[model samples]
Target: MKIFRKLRLQELLYNKKDKRLATAIKLMVGRKPLNLSLFKLAVKHSSAAEETKHGIKVSNERLEYLGDAVLGTIVAEHLFIKFPYRDEGFLTETRSRIVNRESLNQVGKKIGLEKIVESDLTEKGFFTHKSIYGDTLEALVGAVYLDRGYYFCRKFVLSRIISPHFDLDNIINTTINFKSKIIEWSQKENREVDFLLKSITGSQRFKEFTVELKIDQEFFTEGKGPTKKKAEQEAAKNACEKLKLAI
Candidate 1:
């Protein structure tokens, strides 16, 4: 019985290191990865980066950088073709709406990317920064580009990632001025709308802002963002939801 148990343990260990794991990851993105090492590096956060013999640190940061450019280009091309009648400003604004960090995080979550990310935040549970998922998704895109080239990466991104999750038509038609919407709703309902900049944390390069929305002198909802404007907008968005105002 002891020998049987030992064999089972060894099987588990071998399975953990199996290439099938890499193949499974590829299946998630709807494509097989030619170089699994790139995908492995893509999911590795800076906190888990290892030093190589060449005196260089390897992490997903560079991949994320490359993926950001690739994603921007793909998204720009998509927007250009989809909205040929629209002006440059409209195209740019719409593209920003689509490729924003929060949107990408949502997409990443939908694709189960969060389940595979190797990060310090994994042990922290829900307290981790939201940007990690988005960053990892971008890194995966970079890996796909390196492994499969531009055309394949673009197709995978559009078909598996963007097309399934985003409705570009709805996105184009939707207005996102949550603050103004909240204010207008408040005026109609005779409720006082107030936004308070509660606190600012972190250094200049990476500051986080907290904002709270109060309705009729009562706390409605609070939100946090990298900038005061964004924090207020988030707070207002929450307020809008709480009040059941369709945005």
Candidate 2:
């Protein structure tokens, strides 16, 4: 605890939002972080380090690679020892789902790492930037592994991410398209939604559509997507998110 208090850089990197995470890491690691640069790089987006040459300035990507390998090996070993009856095929798929980019991004967002990230990107970077959040999350895991070890990394992941949020029973029945679910909920409540498609512009796979949802043309929620239907879905989703406003 004293060592962690000594690391002013840790305090700087993680602000009030990461309180639980900080406490969890401190308790699980049993030792404060000594290497602050590794943690800094973990939360740093590649765009922020574009001036430095690739494979030289040390973006989190390289650390992500190492972390991915380490996580895979550790998970495989754990599953192997824990579930002696489980087959290799099942283990592989399970590990894949657990370590997928989308899953990591969800955890990263829930933990508020997005706010603490050091990135030079703009609003356009959200969807346009490929795997920034995912990469940053992986780098963070890598940093934890380096700063502490397998035990702490495993403990922190299980506690902060798996136990607190990743409920196996609930997740199985959960709706993946939350935006669409929001719209359906709104419709059931007798709320009318109107989605207006403004534009569709971009090359093939990179195309984007701008849309806005009008609740009686007063309550509006804007969204963008690759197609008109998708854009409308996003707008409806946004509208659903705003239903608590009591308008």
Candidate 3:
């Protein structure tokens, strides 16, 4: 009787928690979640991860990985269909603009993810880790994919997330190829520009690369990103901004 009573109490508490989470998810996603646990896990950051008896930590990292792939594929497909005459490079760059860490972070906050996310980071620490919200957005995408499958997930991404948040026209019209611009400026001025990898941190799945941009053997700026190319691009972007070359 005691064991049964304890199990009943746990179930009741779980149900209460699930009810709150379900309402939040519905307001955010415009649908009721069939599996509430997935959504719960989606909002859980690695900093607040729980360790199991088997010495395994559970968090949203795996879901973030899965969602990154899915989100990339969906965006690629959308751009491909939308820009039939555009070249491969255009499609790739446009997709990058849409799905980059900064863009996703903004979108996540706009969608009120800050209220739902479970994190142990303080307010200052939270702002310091700029990609946390973006990572959580990706994990939420993974949860949506698992809960509702590809077609529904695609619709949610397009109709709910991308369509509502992003301005495609502005994104396409903007000149964000700062790396190319900086290199062209260097060539025109007969100056040597170089990007050197400074350091890499974090685990394999979540590595952050730091790149330093140097011009004429002088340090220009530094940038960090999830990939070497992005880090280099960021460094170049900062350099261009400092030089007043970015249009």
Candidate 4:
């Protein structure tokens, strides 16, 4: 059993296609019995290899498929219990926003998934891309579910992966249309506003995009985040609240 497991790990680690992903597995599942193949399969983008020699292609799409279902079910249960009064539409939209690629990417980057998981080879850059990282995160969940029983997997996901960073209330309510509110307030005040992506720090996945909001050449506020849109929204929200233009 031990030899078989080690061989499987060897195959996953030594394979040219999957070699670049060694660091990612260690970063996320350190000291845990978490099967490394699950993560490798998770990070394998369809673009990496269309097919293997035996006429089988490795891709995270299937894992992603399973992950999508798992994520929806978990989030649904959380919502159902958390907000007994929330209608189906509200719960669905809220879950959608939380599990969407952009949001998942933000979560992954916030947790530093990119730092430990990356391709040393310049051959592919999906590790640092949110579109892929987010998808892979989902696939990883699927893999964990398969390796471990549902209860243990669910517990790990809830306690470690999903719960710490996920603030359902803040996500649902606080991220209101800050930009739109700023625009309306600016119009009311007869002032023009601008949001510029000034500079960017960090990689594409864990990036900190800097944004500057100016009103009629006067700098209103500055903000930074993983996405330009998010930073700009922060700047806008700050400007609005500070100026008492809009709530």
Q: After superposition, how far is residue 192 of candidate 1 from its true place, in Å?
A: 12
Expressed as tens digits, the lDDT of each residue in 1-247 for candidate 2 is 5476565555666666455445544553345556656766676677786444445664577788877776677656656775688788766756655666667677777776776677877788765664566677677778888877878888766666556756654543443463566667657777666667778889987999999776656647888888787787767655654553211
Best by lDDT: 3
Output the TM-score of candidate 2. Answer: 0.55
Task: In candidate 1, list every pair of residues with a backbone clash.
Answer: none
lDDT-superior candidate, 2 or 3: 3
The parts of candidate 4 lying over 4 Å away from their true place are 1-31, 115-130, 178-247
What are the TM-scores, per candidate, against the unseen true structure? Answer: 0.65, 0.55, 0.71, 0.57
Cα lDDT computed for each candidate against the true fold: 0.82, 0.66, 0.88, 0.71
| Model 1 per-residue lDDT tens digits across residues 70-107 | 99999999999987898998988788777877788778
User: Alpha-carbon error at 214 in model 3, in Å?
Assistant: 1.3
Q: State the lDDT at 247 in candidate 3.
A: 40
lDDT of 3 at 125: 77
Alpha-carbon RMSD, candidate 4:
13.1
Number of backbone-clashing residue pairs for each candidate, in the order shown = 0, 0, 0, 0
- State the lDDT at 68 in candidate 2: 76
